[model samples]
Target chain A: MKAVERVDQFYLLKQLPKATALLCKEGNLLDASCSWLEIFGLPPINKKQKTQIFSLLPEVEDLIEKLQEAKSFNLRHEISLNNETRHLKSYFAPWFDEKENVIGTIVQTDDITSEVEKEEELNWLKNIMETKMEVSKTGWWEYEIDTEKLTWCKETKRIHQVPDCYEPTVIEAIEFYKSGYSQNKVSMLFHKAITDYQSYDTKVMIVTFNGEERWVRITGKPFIKEGKVAKIFGTIKDIHNQVIAEHRVKEHQQLLTTLVDSLPLNVYVKDLESRKVLVNKGECSYLHKKPEELIGKTDFDLYDREIAQISREEDIQVMKHLTPIIGKETVSCLNGKTTHFLTSKIPYFDLEGKVCGVIGMGLDITSMKKKQEELCDLIKITSMQNQKLISFAHIVSHNLRSHSANFSMLLGFLNSEKDQEERKRIIKMLTQASDNLLETLGNLNQVLDINTQESETKKTLNLKKSITGVLHNLSAFLENNDTQIINNVADDMVVKCVPTYLDSIILNLVSNAVKYKSPGRPPIITINAIKSDKGVLLSISDNGLGMDLDRYGDKIFGMYKTFHNREDAKGFGLYLIKNQIEAMGGSITVQSEVDKGTTFNVYFNEES
Target chain B: MCILMKKVSCIFIVDDDPITVFGIKKMLKSVADCKDIQIFQNGKEAYDALIERQNLGKPIPEVIFLDINMPIMDGWDFLDEMIELNITEHVVINMITSSIDPLDYKKWADFKDRCPYILNFKNKPIFKIEPNDLGCITAAS
Candidate 1:
């Protein structure tokens, strides 16, 4: 039997796999594979050599005593020889003789250096990934649908403020979401991702283990195996601050919209191209359209071409200059009615401080404008009354003082005169002066009556009819004087004045024209009138003897001052007519040249 | 009585009111030494006669009684013309008038500063004037 076993051992040792060895109980080598010798960098075995395996490979010598119990050992160990290190794996088992007594060890060895090095590299990568997740406040989660297991990463547990020993079920994970909308929405998305093999990303609110509320962004992606979803996993991020900022921005936009819509004045915003971008309720109502319809429309689209053209040019100027145009008054005539507005426009800027558009506001001021016009008219009337009062005072003092002084002087002369004839002469003079004074007083009284009376009761009358009536009354006299009357006043021309005053004004002007007839030609009187901005301008021109205006300009309207030598020149006609015209809110102006004709322009305030 | 009457070369009275002019003329008769006394109904008439006399190389008026209010031209206008013609330096002007306004005296006060020809101002109705009152019109005291 020994012979047979020896042969088996020789064959087995020769044909053993690589790095195999056999050892006696004392760790002496009985046999070794050629690969084993090569692995330890040993020379080939000789027939005279007696070697133990522990002497060849001392790294596993400590396993010799452990094999005395006849137990098997599998180990990983380190070996160094000739300054070269290697990782080694060894399996040891005791062999038994025929009588069942243990003798030596048969050990198998493997060099597993590459696998251990690869495992260390993988651990380094996992460490870096966990660190990154913690810093970003990000964590991952996985739900195994089959086992109903929920696994959370360490950072995920930190986010929930839970202990590391805490492990949650699928239902418990769903409960972490806030009770109402967040829970329902996350649950629905989770189920959908499971059954439909879909992916989802959403923001939801959660109640943590500590009862603190937070906003988080959850993304889910399903992992399908064999066409069935096994697990769903995604990232969860703490987005509380970003989400709160977004909500505040939305609220601010809504507040501005409400504020703009509440104002009664027209407010609108326009883009760089002058297209309306936003409009308030007031602006929409002004255009008689809804806000949606008014937006993107320009001034040219809403107003008359002439009116809008001006406004567009102004807007362009404002944008180009990057300055504001405020409180511009404008007038619009539409549907036979006039409207006034006070408008303002300002340049609006972008985030970069570049002028982007214009914001405009306007207020209706038509009624205010009407009130201002009425105020102006009132002021005119008051000033005119004050001027009349001053003139009356001067006239009264001047006429009375001169006449009284003359009377006193004449009486003084009479008292000193001894000759009866001289006395008689002085008395005659006194009587004549008294008559002159009485007539002067009567004329002054007439002027005083016209001045003191309130604005006369005015009636609208046709200028052509009034002029024709005056010409008719003086027709016979005009014919005797060889005069020709030219009435050019239009039939549509109308003026507001007291009726008798109108008749008297025409009569006085026409008679004066005939009275001052040039000796070289027959008198030619022409009357014309046209509507003017100031009022109705009536021009009565005459081809008659004209006085030197420069010499008599100041006295042309003075009482009791006559320029011409005519015997009938009373010098009261112009002054009386002036007072009458002023009482009715009218004015008269004359243009004349010596030896030429004359023209009188009478402006009468138009009737409202 | 021994004091000799101050004599003027020629005197001009400008007034629109004839009664006042008549009274002034009668009073001037006391100045026997005066060469001539001219009368005009208005300022323009007086100014025109002055120009005519200047052209004729006749004696210019040594004194003139100017009235404030008148037709055609007024005392102020005549004074401006005299200043414009550079002839005011040769005449003594008395702004004689019937105006009783205090404002009129204020105006004369302002004019008196610039116009040396305005020697005196008197009110109207000089019927009881003493002969000594004619001294203001004399060319020599």
Candidate 2:
């Protein structure tokens, strides 16, 4: 039996290569495989005396009893040798005789250290990948075009609110996209990627399995194999929070743009370099350009040199002073219309409290300015009319008072006189007083006539003919005074005036020249009319007893203002002539000296 | 009546109106026992006559009635010229006016400051002389 067992052991050892070992019933080391010796760093066994296995490996001594009792036993053990630990699996089986009684044991050992280390490293890698995917809400996807199979990572499944083990078909995956543009767009992109090997990177809206809306960003890449499109892979990121925040920011910006455009006033922003950075609708229209054209341009590019210089200087001042400047700016448009603006320029500052540019706003005030000027002109005319009315009141008071006084004096004389000759003289004096009273009334009536007459009575008349007619009417008085009248006026010179006023004006001026003649020298009157841009300038000059103008310049055209001591100085002729000339839209001015001469220049409007 | 008893040596009436001059002369003749009376048509004529009298070594009038508002030089101008004449005689002047203009009174007050010889500023139509008017003139002279 022992010989047959030895032969069986030797055959089993030879067949099992380096992993098998044999032991006797006494627990002694018999034969070891080549692999076992190599793993434990042991020397080859010799055939001198049988070796106990305990002495070879002391750690396996406890297992020897179990190995002796059981039919077959297996054990995993760690042994330390040469400062290194090694793991080994040992199996012991009893060798059987023909009578079924155990003779010896067969032992086998395997070096399993590398296999355990590999399994631990694989577990650590799997744990790290799952944690990364959970924190970032990022996942990967793959689509096999041939099989129409789709695969999604754990994070991707979470994003879609699906079970972890769920496998989606290509069509089912695309259905997760919201039904409108997102679904169509994703489907089209999937097909295009597979057929054309195209890559896509875009944001898309998706509806999850639970019917919750979410925003996601997908980046796709196509793979081609054997000259045919095979697979599509990409990353689908859950970017709901980022996309919503960005959308809200865009909405706020659009609202601000609309508010600025709605303002009627011109609003603009300019950079430090005087380049326009932003402009509203009003500003764009004011510049006669679109907003796109105006932005990035300057005042120098949009306006004339003079206007641009004014705007640039104001902007620079506001920025430099870091304060607002408000003022009026007049701009003349290309159509020759002028507009006035009340413009304000304020300095704009950056986050660091530095003046970066200027912000400008302008309000149009052209109509208001025009109305103010018209009001001023109206006030002037009303005041002038009030002065004339006051003067008229004074004339009525003085002239009427003087005439009544004369009548009373004459009546007193007639009542007291007793002598026949004195009585006759007093009667004559009364008659003369009545005549003078009647004459004064006639003169007052004529003044009233001129005052009430409308300007519609004015007509163009020959200036020379008017003067000649007056000279003819006063020829007798002129000859008696030895007055020489020179009418140097052109025969065809016309003046816009009322015919009656023209006749009266000429008569009064000529009569005055003759009446106020100097006692020392005969009067020489010169009448001349010269054509000017405004109208005809008719000047009547006289070498007579001219009064001092300094003392009577303001009073020369006042009623009852007499400068000279003359018998018939009624002080009404020049006053009436001034009123007539002014009524015809003309003006009269007088220059005089104490005894040298006097010149009266009358200016008439060309159209009137 | 008092003027009828007191005799004025020489009286001058200066006025532009011939009727007024004649009436004043007649009233004076009836009131006083005086023959030396002179009349001037205006202030300019009166001034010339006074100057001529001074040059001829004649007696200047003691009482002169001057009318304001005349054709030539008025009463104010006559008074301005009278200051330059350097008249040494004591003469009483009666200024007269036809109208009741307050401006004429204001002018008289200014002239009276320079020429204190003016004794009275009387209104026109002196139909009858009051005894007080003659008494004041005689007292001032």
Candidate 3:
């Protein structure tokens, strides 16, 4: 019986697949396999007493009882050993001896942990693949170029709205693309892939299994084997949303292009390196060239060296920063005229907010700049005249006050005096002072009248007629001075000037000639007006006692300036004559020599 | 009944015009009570005489007639120097001129703050005095 029990233990241990075992008798383990020793947390290839195994694995008694209950009984059971976390599947059977007597129970266990882990991994992989197909909404296809065999993933079949078992050949795949350019394109692409191993990426419309049209983007790469086409694999993507978005963007760009080109101000955009990428019609016109000529060129190509250098520096500044710069500068056009322009340059940026290039716009402001300067000059002149007028007012007031006060005081003294002789003396002196004051006031009034008179209401008047009238008015003076008149004036030459001013100007010139007649010789006056396209050129030359040009050239027409002594020469006439001519937009000039003849030349505007 | 009073002692006329000085002296003799009167034709001549009299221990003129509107020097210029020189402490100065300018009137009215030095203003040699006049004998012996 003891030998049979030992044989039973060895048989159980040999039958187990890498399992531990123990031999037991009378509710105690007698011997065990080396694996059994290790299973019980003992050293390798070492055995322990059955009593120790029975104490550690309390369920061993139950397995023994079940083993004794039936002949050749086979049962599988789980046993816990020493509270460890490993599960053991044990096969139990009754042991037999050499005499074929039932002696003890035998148990065997095999670990199945790795097989379970592989099954879990396969399930996880299937879940991940299914989730990917659902999320990406993508499908893939492979084509065997030599065999013309095509395979589609399940998701690909679903995307085509077809059944799971559907199979399509290369010809069918090409036919699946709609007829027309799509079919042609696919045929060429597939032929290229087979012969030349060229890949293709394109969008095409297709009819699905449900008879519905849909847009798809197909990308392909060919597999080459031994320098021969083997197979082609690619992806089919549903990019309908992206295609629509791109179409809208193209439409918006077309509208914006039209609007920018129509603007009067020149507008242009540069690329990533400040090279001209876009130019509008107005911008091209400034260069005297077409838009195509300006493209791919920078400012240095279009502008002169100095201007281009300045503009390029500004463009570089904008490209290096995110701020906008605006400046006004003059640009020399092809016509050689400098045009003032207000320029604005701003940085262009990509969506990531990095500096890309610059966009510049220029508004032509040449006329506006000229007008502003003219207005400033007019303001300066007006203010200067205003200062002179204020001073004139003060002087007039002071002089007039002094004279009036003296007159009033003289009147008071005359009234208070009773002595006949003294009153007579005072009256005579007052009369002389009043006469001088009257003369001064009269001169002032004459200048003021000429300055205030408006010449805008002038009409076309015959210059010869006005000059003749002046000669007639001054006939007595000329006769008294024994002045000889030499008239070679144009007969009907007309000019645009106030008639009264023309008469006054001629009268003053003739009278001055007569008044300054030489003492030794009679004055000889020559009057002539030459008619030309510009205007009538009137000259009045006098062989009189003329003054020195060096001394009187600047002050020849100044008010209260008298060169010769004549009782009626108040010196206000020439000044008034000059003022009148200027008010009518005419010019007067004089040439003189001391003790020689003087000549007055006048230019009058001719009406168109 | 009024007690008799002595006439004004010396009358001095300071003016640039000799003719105006002669006219004033003749008119003053005809119009006002006068005794011995002396006339100086300019501020410098008049200022020197007053200072010399002070040195000689003689009484200064009782009446001095000053004129503005003169060449080289005038009445107001004389008053400025006279105050500095202290030439006359007891004499009365009367400004007389042909200048009827209101600005001149206002200027002289303000200038009268150096009173007794510039006592009053009259129109030239007419010698008309108002009720406000602080009358001192203009010419006396």
Q: Which candidate leads the pack in DockQ?
A: 1
Docking class for model 2 is incorrect
Off by over 4 Å in 2: A1-312, A328-343, A360-367, A409-428, A468-492, A517-524, A562-569, B1-141
**lDDT string, candidate 1, A378-444, tens digits:** 8977886777677667777777887787788889888888989979878887887798799889998
Q: Model 3, range B11-117, lDDT digits (tens) per residue?
A: 67786544456456644653446676777655666777878887898777767778764323457767777777665456667787655567778877887775546
Candidate 1, after superposition: displacement of residue A205 in Å?
5.7
lDDT of 1 by residue, B1-141 (tens): 433455777988887766677767755665536768888867778889988988898888877878887766778778777766566345777787777777778878877787756456777755554433444433444
Q: Write down the C-alpha DockQ for each prediction.
A: 0.36, 0.20, 0.04
Best by TM-score: 1
Clashing pairs in 3: A29-A50, B8-B139, B8-B140, B9-B140
Ranking by TM-score: 1, 2, 3
Q: Of the pair 1 and 3, which is ahead by lDDT?
A: 1
Q: Tens-digit lDDT track for model 2 on A224-327? A: 89998888888898999998999899899889888888977788999998899999998888767898898899988877788788889988988988879876
| TM-score comparison, 1 vs 2, better candidate | 1
Question: What's the distance in Å from true for residue A5, model 1?
Answer: 28
Cα lDDT for residue B89, candidate 2 = 85
Q: Cα lDDT of model 1 overall?
A: 0.81
Ranking, lDDT, top scorer first: 1, 2, 3
- TM-score of every model versus the real structure: 0.64, 0.62, 0.46
lDDT of 3 by residue, A65-183 (tens): 56457444433334445664444455555566799666665555554445545777999997887678668877789988667689987877876788999998777777777889878
